[model samples]
Target: MKKQFFYIVLMGLVAPLASCNDFLDMEPMSEITPEDYYQTVDQVEEFTNQLYADILTTHGSYSSTFEIDKDTDNQPSTETPGNKYDNTGQWKVSMDNSSWSWTNIRNVNYGIEVITENYENGTITGDETSLKQYLGELHFLRAYAYFSMLQKWGDLPILTQAFNDDEATLVEASKRSPRNEVARFILKDLDLAAKYMTPDFETSHTRISQDCAYLMKSRVALFEGSWLTNFKDTPFVPNGNGWPGTAKDYNKDYQFPAGGIDQEAQFFFQEAVKSAELVAEKYKNSLTRNTGITPQSVSDVNDYFYMFGDDDMSTYPDVLLWREYNKGLGITNHLEVIVQGGYDVTRSMVDCFLMEDGRPVYNSSIPYDDQTIAKARSNRDPRLVAFMKQPGQINYFINEDYPADHARKDEAFPPLDVGDGTVNRSLTGYRIRKGGSFDKARCDQWNSYTGSIVFRATEALLNYIEAEYMLTRNIQAGHILEYWKLIREAAGFTGAAADPQTTNTYTSIDKEKADWGAYTAGKLLTDVTLYNIRRERRCELMAEGLRWMDLIRWRALDQMCKTPYHVEGFRLWDVMQNEYDLEPADYDGGNDAFVTPPSRGQYIIAYENIQEKSNLYRDGLHWMMAHYLEPLPIKQFLLTSSDHADVELSPLYQNPYWPLVADSPAEQ
Candidate 1:
């Protein structure tokens, strides 16, 4: 089979620059310049295609991609040194210089500038449709780059135009725009993109289409709106206590586009609702179903599992954007292998899934003590059985001959033994089975040609529900019940439809008791409606690199540091230890050195015995308010001060709570 158009883009961008000294140099006959480039629709499209390779394909390693979900309540990495945010004193102001970089923004802006100038100057002729579509893609890509920056560093220097290498021009572009203004700019770009973009791209789901723009607009708006709502009174948001943004003398009394902060939030939430509703309505019937799914057999096509792992996603209309891979071309990834080995789905994440009967897993009918691997796997949400690896379950379908010592191949419930021969074994007993393929031949291949779903309509559904509820606190609005039913139905839950009036017999109260981080921080999900919506999101999108962002926007990291919350694994200490023939000697250190035996029937607290050395919840995970918005690099401030000596201090302001020192400030 021929490789997909996705690889063509990679080759188109890389082949041209492989031998060039400077991509922008004007002199050489061999080198391409802006004048030579953008002369044709093909060149312009290829230029925009590079954005996908740079931004999206950078996450080709499934292990590293999923690692974003680890060290949080939802998941944990088997190899533990703990994440920077987990320690009380590890996260420092100078640790992240890349967040200060604007290379991607500059590239995107340059592309836009070249295209707009060329089109207006009549230097290039094109089918107007193709030219406008390429322009829309650039705008969307620029907005995407800015959205990424906004997430990491709250306020940013909104650089719409590309600057030359001159220092004065660089310094002029360095003044930080207010966070709210940055969000509005992103929305404006998306609106322009939607106006010029086609509804769908012809080359599968890899390219930016009209729906992709709407979905992203919803995602960006919801993130900003929720951040403002949850943290309105805190310093992390603009115009709040200790907020670092300033309206320079020229724009000191700046008013939000929607009057004030509260109104501004409502404005974005409404935008989120508008955009999300459009996509959700357009793709309401796009959910992929396992038509031939059975208790013992799973079809290799047309199912949720295949949608995530298969090389072709054209059949799944719900997937608005996807990255295709080709093994023959040497463009492949081991996402399936990583799913089988590298990470563990936390017990808290598993518990987040509601039972098949639409009840919490912790309901009195299904108490926590009854949660053995076998018991927990039975009658739970079909997703639990479908997406998670249980003890003694076959991981892959192809019956391949292999060394007996292969860590995961044909292994039944690969023990959570870190020292096991396989590098892919889980630290927590629960392994991720979501994207593992049944085809064993492709499992361990270096360039595994499994496609990656970049965006799906499912997210738009969830976004609409959240934005609508947050804006009006009404679950009945915009077919909330209808969309939720679709999610449940897609997950293989066949029951009487969910009723908003009927309270679930099981409450998150018990589950929250085990995961103290659930109730702490500023997370105030007291209402059943909101709690259920949040629960649905967590369960549906687990291990998808979104949990950390959700937690940050919700301001849910504070409680994690209040006390050392135990990051518990499966009830392996109670059940699997004996069942798997595991011994104390199998651990990192023998008996007294490794794990401390839990009281019978209790869950395994990871690294409980050697907490100090393991970095696993030893000091507890903490989040400083300043961490809400990453600090601009101290070097940037120093450069500004030295370059513009006439100005006594740099015009830039540091995010609140971050000291100018290289080390962390005293504990909050």
Candidate 2:
């Protein structure tokens, strides 16, 4: 079943589990009962197969983890891209969260109940290991669904068993559990998954494995721990000050599992460290290495350069799981064009990288010029060089007999002075090369078969480093130190041994203000050590579809409450503007402009170049307390609002500063 990843199994699963309309899609499915259907290991495999494809499918609408991760600080686009992050007013109370409903969880829960009972009661029979692996896959998928829900809406109902449509039963299950409890529940499921699943299940790299379970658990725990620690005494936490949950009877005095916020945070951080270290240890010998070669040096091969682009990701053991698309099967994606032109990797993100001498770029004596793309990437972490695309670098570094693909021009910097359909242009001058390929077959539109990495072991080490620091305040010691070195070395640093202390000591907020990593929850971090720990994670996982989660948990936008943060790209005015057809003054068209004004700053301001007068982020991107957690749509409350005039008694509470009124913005 895992080998069937590249094909059309996703659309053809007869289980009606796509989004179970009722508790378990109670509509007839060939008139098969749980007992009758759960007769073989093959049935179990079919039941849970689509979950792998559907659960984490499209990490974002971009269809690639390495994307122009807009909305967050890392990748900002013009036309007020996802204005919710810029102005709270852009966020109206959703009418319904029906799209992210419990249907997926219910489907997974139904599978769990049936499979466990059938296996235990002899209703199903198969090779013991195979059956357990299938069951474990179900558990893993359920945890993944709940974890995603936790990020969107903090407190989620920890549903373990499938329920009937009894009105009282359904409503009771709708009660949102405290986020920490949900995190713990997710961890428990992951443990069950790991216990039954082995590393590289069925010796296939595409399937859910024990190591993948560990990596995911670490990520989930790190998120909860960080959220708890940062939003400690705020209304965001379960029993924090002015919490909306406290107004409800069920959560009036919500006692945390570890007695209090601080202890509970520590508990989660410990879980993160423990689980992360397990995978970190497992993959200590197998992490990918950077060969210090860019895509331009196609003649001289670099394993790191080709890892993401390679369709056969199975060769890369560090990649725990990747979605393999087959060109023969007519299943492919247009990733090369996106990465070739690149995601709008923020100017601040580029500045965040440290010098090769184990020192902050601001303080290091290394020539720190950022006017050109070459200057910005020079003398910095090798991860920057390996990933950032430059102009004149050939897109077709491999087979070029295809004249159509060969005729494609070398990457050109996009006209920042313009707006509207930026098909294959770099919004920020800095283009991404991480998941890019030069292979002729993958170069064409919608014909790319570059495997999308689902989980990488590098993140487990990163999770361990940050969670340990958050818990113990000691990074660069013991396994933390070892993991830090491993990441730095793999990133092609090729310099002094990895030292977080030296880097932290030199990381000045005033000198490096472009980097929002130094700030947490609107306040500038005085704890430079903690800042550096976060810096490592930021560098390692850039453009990997994890920035939003990291920012939300860090409460990184809190400072935006006091001052809006204008997201900027490379210095277009100083050097690159001459390369384009337009100039600063020429960008004066009220609506038809394609470039940002140079008068604003040296760098290209992403949101300021928009044509729309209604653009909320024309000035700068702002934030709200409620923006961290999505507003629980009104329809959810209305569903249980019956019999309880006060909606608070309806088993759900509006998040933080958001009101119950439909279409209302965050009150804060």
Predictions in order: lDDT:
0.67, 0.74
85: Cα error in model 2, Å: 2.0
User: What RMSD, rounded to one decimal, does every model reach?
Assistant: 6.0, 5.0
Q: Provide the lowest-lDDT 10-residue window in model 1.
A: 3-12
Per-residue alpha-carbon lDDT of candidate 2 for residues 101-170, written as tens digits (9 for 90 to 100): 6656766777788789889888776787888888898899999998888898888767777544445666
Instruction: Find the 10 residues in a row with the least total lDDT in model 2.
Output: 1-10
Estimate, for each residue in 1-668, the C-alpha lDDT of model 1 and write its tens digit: 21111110111111122233543333212245565778878777777777766656333444335556776788865555344455556667773376566666667777787789998887767687888888998898889888888888887778776444444545556777778789999999999999988766465877788999999999999999988887886767777766656434423555677888899999999999999999999888878864323122354343776777777977788988887778788787767666655357767777776666677765635454434766766667777767666555665565455322223644466455545465655555666666666555666646466777778899999999889988888877777888888877787766552443332335655455544234535444466777777778887787777886787777766654455556666776655666765555554343333443554236765555444454445433545555666766566665555343323366566777766655555234
TM-score of each: 0.88, 0.92
Instruction: State the local distance difference test value for candidate 2.
Output: 0.74
Q: Model 1 Cα displacement at 380 (Å)?
A: 0.6
